[model samples]
Target chain A: MTPAVAFQKTSRHFGAVRAVDAVDLEIKPGEFFAMLGPSGSGKTTCLRLIAGFEQPTSGSISIFGERAEGVPPYRRNVNTVFQDYALFPHLNVLDNVAYGLMVKGVGKDERHRAAEDALKLVQLPGYGGRKPSQLSGGQRQRVALARALVNKPKVLLLDEPLGALDLKLRESMQEELKQLQKALGITFVFVTHDQGEALSMADRVAVFNDGRIMQVGAPEEIYQRPASRFVADFVGSSNVLPPDFVQRYAGQHRWGSLRPEQIRVRSDTSGDGVAARVVSRHYLGAATKLSLDANGLRLHATLPSGTAVPEDGAHVMLTFNRDQLHLMEEQA
Target chain B: MRSDRSQSAPTGLKIAAAAGLAFLHLPILLIFVYAFTTEEKSYQWPPPGFTTQWFAVTWGRADVWQALGLSVQVAAISTGIALVLGTLCAAAVSQTRFFGREAISLLVILPIALPGIITGIALRSAFSLAEIPFSFWTIVLGHATFCVVVVYNNAVARFRRTSGSLIEASMDLGADGFQTFRHVILPNIGTALLAGGMLAFALSFDEVIVTTFTAGQQQTLPIWMLEELVRPRQRPVTNVVAMVVVLATLLPILAAYYLTREGDQIAGAGK
Candidate 1:
């Protein structure tokens, strides 16, 4: 099947600022894909382009193998859940949810019934009469979700939909969104800057930076084998081996990275790897992450709670198999 | 604690507040008093006895009726023009960005900022230079200048307070431009526009400075009142007409104030 959406060398510029630069990508149907980056990284711009709020300055975009050029947002077969929820203050919850169908000239009774069912889908069954001002931040977010989903579009675009929620609510909403995607079998392209959110909820993650895609892959693949130094530091915490060490061991053409957990911390000095002394140790319930100073080079080691962890200032050896170090080609 | 707070108001402050209220309202009180006075020609205070005859006399004047009708017509037409132009101006200034946007905003508010006499003189010269004769429409055009400013003032504030995302959401939810305006933007600004329209009507009804330059031979209510004051006709009858103008303009202003008091709590305002 053709992908749900595709961007062909799409670029959008706001005067001197290149908001999205030469991006080529595709989103498959019924998949939960995430665009992950920091603010000003063009993630939200890409989402806007897909939603048809913005047109590309150059190149083209297509929805389900058809060109979407010059199409107004209302005519598009996608809906967006804005970052601020953007629920119409003038409409009650039910009317807000039913707005799409109303615009399409659906009968009031049928649209109201569908809207009520959509509200129930987002767990806001009895909230039809309340104004948006009466709801909490989380409830408003759910209403925004219901408003978008009620349209039953071919794809749903969410721009940091949970950024305003508290940690507990954000976590639960993430799960709810994942389940909703699965149940509806609709393509979901969510944009967020929170790395953990992308890692935990998405089947595939596209890491963006400086208006360009740095890498795109499954969560584990992107985390374990980052395409560039930026992704290594951004997607998750990782210790980058010094350039000299990488040249000496992995050859000069590649950079080496080792996950914190991949480094073994032994209290004794008998090890095949480099010798180090523990500088600090953090007790993280099921594991202990120790910061080690190995011959003036720093390394982080995460030991499972079952292993013996070295005390601060204790002499130890750090060991990792050569195969555990991941390498990436040097960028030109 | 409440008693102590109430007592804390100094005697001097109390007298000052009372004096301010009296200074503003004493003339209006005098107008009401003289309207009921039996003395028809001369100003005698202590010998005056109150009667209801002047109201009947004022009601029987055909000039006063024509003047009142003309004033209402001018005010109504001017307010209608202001509502459409002012709303369009406010929406453009608040909702979109382009070159000279700030300049356009300043121009929209300039008519009210300038002294009424200056606007009056400028309008008189422009109408003459363009060879347009002063008539009912000229007076309406003059009133609409300031009335547009009043409506624009209320409308732009409300528009800025309203969320831009609401419009985007409407479009994303399959609403075209007209549908989004009808379903989302209109409701948000409805109360504000009503309040603005009422205020514009009241201001146009009481307007004299601009009307003086624009009314060629027609006498609106204010011009009629001015002429009546100039000549010593049944002075009590003039007072009765003044009382009607006060109530006619006062009610809309008060209604506008109440309407706008609750407008700030717009459903999703600031959110």
Candidate 2:
């Protein structure tokens, strides 16, 4: 079977700034894929490219095995849930969700029925007559989802659909979206800058930076063994050891990194591990994060809140299993 | 909610507000009072007697009916033309960007910004130079220059306030360009256009300076009233027509104001 969406050296440049650099990515069918990066990292641009909103400036993009060159967004068999929801202000909930079918000349009754079903899918039944302004932020977000998914496109492109929601709402919506994607079994390409959002929901993730994909792998693979220094630092908190330290301890050539949680902390002060001083401690409800100074190198570690860690500014020893260390090539 | 501020205001402010309302409306009230005055030839401070005979006399005049008919026709046609041209110009300026966009916007508004006499002289000379005959169409064409600006002002403001994402979302949901315009853009701007068209009609109905230049031999109601004022025959008759003009123009202006007052509360507006 053909890949859901493919970018063959696709690049889009606005004037001198390359928003999406030469990117080649293949998203598999029925996969819940995520494009993860910070702001200005070309993740949204890549999603726009697949939705046919921004045409590639150089190479070509293919959707569902067909060249999507010059195909307008309306003609493409894809839908986008815009970051701001972008629901039609002039329309009622039912009309907004039924807009796609209405444009395709579907009968009013048929489109209304389908829209109601879609609303139910998003668990927003009986919200058909209300205007978008009448709905709350999370409700509007779901209405946006219903509007996009009512058409049953081959792929659903979500552009940070949860960016406008509060934290608790975002978490619940994330679970609902993951479950919805599984139930629909369509290629779901979600774009977000929140690493937790990307990690907790996506089956596979493509990490992007500076208009380029730094790494693409399963969530565990990306979290465990990143391909580059940027990926290792961006995906989660990591204590990236300096090159001189790696040369002294690991080898002369390898670059080493370890997750903060993997670093073990003790106050015995006589163990076979690096000696460190606890400079600061942040007491989170479930876990405590500590900033440690290990032989003049600053490092971060997370420990369970109940752990009997050393007091602030107290001397301690930090250790980690050698197998937990990740190595990467030195970037030029 | 601000009762303290109102209570703190001096009595002089309340007197001044009452004076302001009287100053603005006293002449119109005088016009109405004289429309019923028994005297026909000269001004009177307080009429000796009130009568309804002048109303019938003014109703029987054939010339007044002709001019009133002509004025209504011209206002209607001019408003129609203004609606189309004004909406199109507004859409082009508000929805797209290009070189000289600001210049074009300024040009669109120049006719309304410049003094009416200047616009009248410009249109009169242009018509004469182009050898177009002065007719009903000439009067409509003259009124349209400023009428278009009125409509354009209201429409451009509305078009700018409406979010562009609505149109993009329409197209994203499989709407063609025309479909998107019909479903999204038109509904958003519809009330604005209606309010604009009403204001344009009100202005066009009582237009005199431009009509003086463009009407040639044709007589709109204001031009007829001007002739009646100059000739000074049965002055009460002219007062009756003035009352009619006031009501005719006032209705549309009042309607337009109400239409736009609630326009800010658009349905489904984003928070």
Candidate 3:
């Protein structure tokens, strides 16, 4: 099956800053693919390239397998819900939603009907006449979402669409956006700086840094088998120990990552695990996250609530299952 | 927060503002008040009597009619020219970065910022140097030099405040260059253009100094009023015409105020 979008050594620069490096990837059709990175990782730049708001400086970008180098943003067969929810402040909700259809010369009555349909799909019905400023933040977001969806694009790009919402509202919108994507069966390319957002919402997450996609995989794969030290530290916290390749589980001097939730607490012992002492304990609901100081290295381990809780500054053994750890070649 | 500050003005400041408003408008109110007084030219502290006979007489005179018609024609023509030249200049200066962007901005706004006497004298000398005899067209051109600045100020501020995203959004949605500007940019700046046009027309309507310099052997309303003030033949007409000018100028100012009410919203530049 043809990928919905593809980049072939695409590069873009703003002045002297390499906003997007020469990178290659293929986004499968109907996949909720997220470019996951911290601020300035070129995730948003890639979305802009796909949306035709920007052109790759020296490489190729293909949308639906067609060369999109010269295509302007308006002519692109994709739409974006901007981070700030760039709703037209002058127009009321109904007119803002009907904008694309109206611009395409659709009749007033039909465009309004279709706009109403899109509004209902976002679970907001009959809010058509209220101005954007008059609506709450969530309502404005839904209106912006409706504005993009009204055009019926094959690929919907979201530029941190939920970044502006409060914590509880953001969670609900994330689930709703995911459900909407599935229901529409449209390809989605979401750009975000929050790792948790990418982990939770996307089927495939592409980890990026310094303008390059370091690794791309399912959220589980990225979390469990990060390919590099940067990915290990970026996806979740990690504790690195010098490898004992010969004596321990074969080829063990390579840096390894441990998930915070992947470790177990045991009695005051030092065998069947990396020998360590608990330096600090943070009590969280249903679990207590502990930081261990193991022979000059700091390690993170999360233990489920049980009688196995260890006192702070107590010497204890921490064991990670051998197979759960992947050796990463530490860069010199 | 700033809105709250304005709302919480002290009583002293509030009274001062009111006094300033009266200082500016009380003379105009006096002109309107005496427009109906039977006392012709002499200052009657309070009117001895009031009559509408002067209004009837002012309405019937051919010279008054011609002068009124001339002022209307000049204001209309000057406004049209200002709308075109000002919008184009504003768009050019705003959209493109050039070697002389600052100089161009200064040139565009200098007419409005400079004293009217400066503009009048400069235009007069320029006309003499060009050997162009003064006429209605020359008057329109002179008036438009300043009027265009008004239009340019309004339109450019609106253009700058309009998010480049809207234009990009339009282009990305498949609109060609002209269609993008016509549908997206035009609607966004529509009120600014209307406001600018109304303001330009008002400024041109009561303009006297510039007209005096360029109105060769012609009788516009302000010039006619000046002549009537100096050589009082049928001079109660001046007071009536003053009332007419007061109303005509006020109407456009009101319309412009209405049009520009949301300009602050549309003109939100990146602060």
Candidate 4:
């Protein structure tokens, strides 16, 4: 089957700024894919390129095997759920949801019925009569999702759809969106700055930085074996050991990543481990995060809640399982 | 704390607000008071006596009717032309980026910013240079020059406030350009346009300086009233017509105010 969306060396530039630079991407049909990056990293620009709101400066795009570059968004068989929801304030919930069908010349009764069904899919039944302003932020988000889903497009582009919601609502909506993508089996292209959201929700994740794809892989692979220093630093909090530190520990002069949780702190200094001094300690509910100085290099360790942690300014031995230390391919 | 501060406004501030309102409205109240005065020839400290007969006399005057008719026609046509041209200009300025876009926006608003006499003299000379005779249409053309500024100001502000994502979302949902405008953009800016149109109508109706230069042989209500003031036949009648002008202009302005006061409530605003 043809890929849901493909970009061939797509680049979008605004004057001197390279918003998206030579990005070649393929989103598989029926896969939950995420373009994850920080702000100004071109993730949202990539989503807009797929939606045809933007034309690439020097590339070609195809959607479901059809040429999409320069094709107007109205003619594309795709829909977008904007970060702001963008629900029409003038229309009630039903009309807003049914807008796509109505524009396609669906009859009023049929379109309204379809809108109701879409609302039900988002678990917002009987909310068809309320104006968008009357609904809370989460409800508005659901309405935006319903509006996009009502069109039943082959590809759905979401630009930080849960970004405006509070943390609890965001978590719940993430689960709902994941389940919805599975049930619908449509290609979902989600763009977000939150790495945890991307890792937990996307089947395959593409990490973007400075207008380029840093790495793309399964979420587990991305977490377990980041390919670059940027990915290791951005994806999660990891103690990026220098090549000299790695050479001292594992006899390899390669940059390595050791997760904070993987570092074990021994109170007694009688061990064949790196001698370190605890510089500071933070008591989390279920864990204690320690900032340590080992041979003038700063490293962090997360000790489990039940472990007895030494006070700040105390010397300790820091040990890690040899297999838990992952080497990075990038020099810096 | 907010309620406490709001409830205890300073007495000096309260007196100042009342005095400000009285200063603004006392002249208008004087116009209303003199409209009922029986005196016809000269100014008086107070009304000699109140009478309802001048209203009957003012209603029967054909010249008054003719001036009122010309004023209404000029205002209506000028507002219609301003609405179309002003909205188009606003859309161009607010929705697109090009070289000299800011300059174009400044040119659109320049008529209202310059002194009215300068605009009038400029328009009068331009009309004469073009060999266009001053007629009722000339008055409308003059009124529309300033009226467009009113509508354009309101429309451009509203267009800026409306989120661009709404338009993008409309297109993403499969709406063509016209459909997006009709279903999304229009609704978002509908009240603003209405308010702008009303204000344009109000401005065009009472325009004196521009109309004086443009209307060579025409007598809109204000021009007629000006002539009547110079050579008095019934001073109270001019006052009655002034009352009529005040009501005509005041209603639309009040409506415009109420329409736009809640403008920030537009959908997806601040999102």
- Candidate 4 local lDDT, A91-180, one digit each (tens): 999999999999999999999999999999999999999999999999999999999999999999999999899999999999999999
Top model by TM-score, which number? 1
| DockQ of each two-chain model | 0.83, 0.69, 0.38, 0.80
lDDT of 3 by residue, B1-271 (tens): 4466556778999999999999999998888777788877675769888888999999889999999899999999999998899899988887778889989989888777777788889999999999999999999998898889888888998888877676666665556688777877788778898888887887888788888988898888888888888763545678888988887678767776777776453221110
User: Cα lDDT of all candidates, in order?
Assistant: 0.89, 0.89, 0.83, 0.90
Off by over 4 Å in 3: A240-253, A264-279, B1-22, B33-51, B60-63, B84-107, B124-138, B155-164, B172-184, B212-220, B262-271
Model 1, span B1-271: residue lDDT tens: 4466545678899999999999999989888888988888775785369899888888898999999999999999999999999999999999999999999999988888888899899999999999999999999999999889878888898999899988999999989999998988999988888888888888888889999998899999888888887676688888898887788678876777777886452111110
Which of the numbered candidates is closest to the native, going by highest lDDT? 4
Per-residue error for B17 in candidate 1, Å, reads 2.1
Cα displacement (angstroms), candidate 3, residue A181, comes to: 1.9
Score candidate 3 by TM-score against the native.
0.85
Which digits, one per residue and each the tens of the lDDT, describe model 4 over residues B163-240?
A: 888898999988999999888988888888888888787777777899889988889988888889977668899999
Residue-wise lDDT of candidate 3 within A137-242, one digit each (tens)?
A: 9988898889899999989999888888899999999999999999999999999888899999999999999999999999998887888878888887754444
Task: Evaluate model 2: give its lDDT.
Answer: 0.89
Q: Write the per-residue lDDT of candidate 1 for residues A1-332, one digit (tens) a residue.
A: 89899999999999999999999999999989999999999999999999999999999999999898789999999999999999888889999899999999999999999999999999999899999999999999999999899999999999999999999999999999999999999999999999999999999999999999999999999899987888988888887776677766667656678899998777667747678988999999999989889888788888999887767899987778778788864452
Give the TM-score between model 4's chain B and the true chain B: 0.91
Candidate 2's C-alpha runs over 4 A off are A252-254, A268-272, A329-332, B1-9, B125-138, B263-271
Q: What is the lDDT of residue B145 in candidate 2?
A: 90
Per residue, candidate 2 scores C-alpha lDDT tens digits across B228-258 of 8767568889999999888867876677777
Chain A TM per candidate, in order of listing: 0.95, 0.97, 0.95, 0.97
- Per-candidate alpha-carbon RMSD to the true structure: 3.4, 3.6, 4.5, 3.8
